[model samples]
Target: MKTTITVNGEARALDLDTRVTLLDALREHLGLKGSKKGCDHGQCGACTVLVNGVRINACLSLAVMHDGDEVTTIEGIGTEAALHPLQQAFLTQDAFQCGYCTPGQICSAVGMLQEAAQNWPSQATEDLTAAIALTDAEIRERMSGNICRCSAYPQILAAIRDVAGEPA
Candidate 1:
């Protein structure tokens, strides 16, 4: 089947099987390999990407379903010369050890910030205050899906808090 999806602000047209996951389509078909294939079951979140400014596991979604949706991968965030705020914070904080999950972590953080900015309430948000205060628990809960085998949770949370402009 022929499918066309906008990826990283580019219109990608391809003929693919119905079973092709978005991760494979991005890495194999469109040559956008930033989204990793960690668990291939949506458990690892290594294939995390943004669709319409929301984070999702690419391995659990089909490519053809995102025909007109805007998908943003790690490459779309920033370049080596100009890194996004979250990216810069991650680098400055030394968030990752092995660096395998860095791309997904960065992308997830970008989407997470947007989600936070939108005042999306979480389970722990008992009081719908004027503005949501980014707490360490909130960050951890929001990023629970993205696992880090290196156990770099402290640095990752620090980086996110820094980008979020919240005192830790």
Candidate 2:
């Protein structure tokens, strides 16, 4: 099967097997290595990416399923000269210690803010009908999927809250 994906604002196509996972397609074929392969079982958020402005685990879906979809990876979030606010917040907050999970965290954080803005219901939210608020509890719930083994979670949460305009 042939699929065209808009990755990082670039149109790219590949002849992939229907069984090929999006993570494999991104790393193996497209050479977008920002999304990690952590568990490769959808259990880990390491392979998370934005699909049409939503965060998803690339390993959970097939490449053919994303035909003509707008995909955004961590690399697409910003450039070396101009970093995304979440990237800058992560850097300033020292969100990662080993750095392997940084890509996933950054990607997840980017989409998370968008999700929050959309009034996505979270367990921490006292009122779901109101505009989503970025409380420390809510940030933790939204970022629950991404794990940082280096114990940099405090900084990670701080960075995300900062970008979301929620104080530490």
**RMSD of model 1 against the true structure:** 1.1
lDDT of 2 by residue, 1-168 (tens): 989998988999889989999999999998889899999887768898999999999999999999999999998989999999999999999888889889998999889898888888888889867877788999999899887778798999988888788665
Model 1 lDDT on a 0 to 1 scale? 0.90
TM-score each candidate: 0.96, 0.96
lDDT by candidate, in order shown: 0.90, 0.89
Per-residue accuracy of model 1 over 56-149 as CA lDDT, tens digit each: 9999999888878899999899999999889899989999999888889988999988888999977657687767788888899899899999
Model 1 clash pairs are none
Worst 10 residues of 2 by lDDT: 159-168
Cα distance off (Å), candidate 1, residue 95? 0.3
Question: Cα miss at 93, model 1 (Å)?
Answer: 0.4
- Where in model 1 is the C-alpha error above 4 Å? 128-130
Clashing pairs for predicted structure model 2, backbone only: none
